[model samples]
Target: MIKHIVMWKLKNPGDAAKFKAQLDSCKGLVPGMREFEAAVRTEGLEANVDVVLVSAFDDRAALQAYLEHPVHVEVSGVLGGLRESRTVLDYET
Candidate 1:
């Protein structure tokens, strides 16, 4: 399986909910999506980023399909406008 993790620091921290919601919208968007989770940092958490997404795919091809899906592309555009910095990691597990 492929593990995909993304952390984002928003241009405006107040928009974290919107950012998370946009990501959540992509759940079950593509075939071979094993898992999908999006979360906002807790109020008292010690973290550098504002939001996170942890997902798993059956393989590299499935991960690629998710990345290229139209719904994902649209959601990414929304996320792009809201984020100041973004970090991503993808590796086989």
Candidate 2:
């Protein structure tokens, strides 16, 4: 299995909820998407990042398919402008 994890620091922290909602729209959009989750940092937490995504795929190919899917592409466009910084980690499990 492949795990894809990402963290984002938004230009405006207030936009976290909106960004998470937009990201949630991409769930189940493609095959082999075993798990998909997005969350914002809890209130009063000493965290720099605003949003995080934790997802699982069958393999690298499955992860690639999700990245290239139209829904994901559209979601990325929206996220691109809202985020100031982003980080990602992918690994087999």
Candidate 3:
């Protein structure tokens, strides 16, 4: 299995919830996606980023499909415009 994790630091922290919503919209958008989750950091948490997305895929090919999927491309385009920075990790699990 493959795990895909991403964290975003938004230009406006207030948009964290909105960003999480956008990320949530991607749920079930592709096959071979095992799990999809999005979350915003708690108000008092020691988080370096505002929003985070965690996803699991059946395999490396599945992860690649998710990245190239058109729905993801569009959503990511919008999300990309709102974030100051992004960190991503994809690895076998």
Scored by lDDT, model 3 comes in at 0.92
Quote each prediction's TM-score: 0.98, 0.96, 0.96
Worst lDDT 10-window in candidate 3: 22-31
Deviation from native of the Cα of residue 13 in model 1, angstroms: 0.6
Pairs in steric clash, model 1: none
Question: Which candidate number would show the highest TM-score if scored against the true structure?
Answer: 1
Candidate 1 worst ten-residue window by lDDT: 74-83
Residue-wise C-alpha lDDT for candidate 2, range 41-64, written one tens digit per residue: 998878878999999999899899
| lDDT ranking, best first | 1, 2, 3
Off by over 4 Å in 2: none
lDDT of 2 at 71: 86
| lDDT of candidates 1 onward, in order | 0.95, 0.94, 0.92
| lDDT tens digits, residue span 2-37, model 3 | 999999999999999899888998898878999999
Cα lDDT tens digits, model 1, 1-93, are 999999999999999998898899999998899999999999886999999999999999999999999999999987898999999999998
Q: Which regions of candidate 3 deviate over 4 angstroms?
A: none
Clashes of each: 0, 0, 0
Candidate 1 C-alpha error for residue 15, in Å: 0.3
**TM-score-based ranking, best first?**
1, 3, 2
Each candidate's root-mean-square deviation in Å? Answer: 0.6, 0.8, 0.7
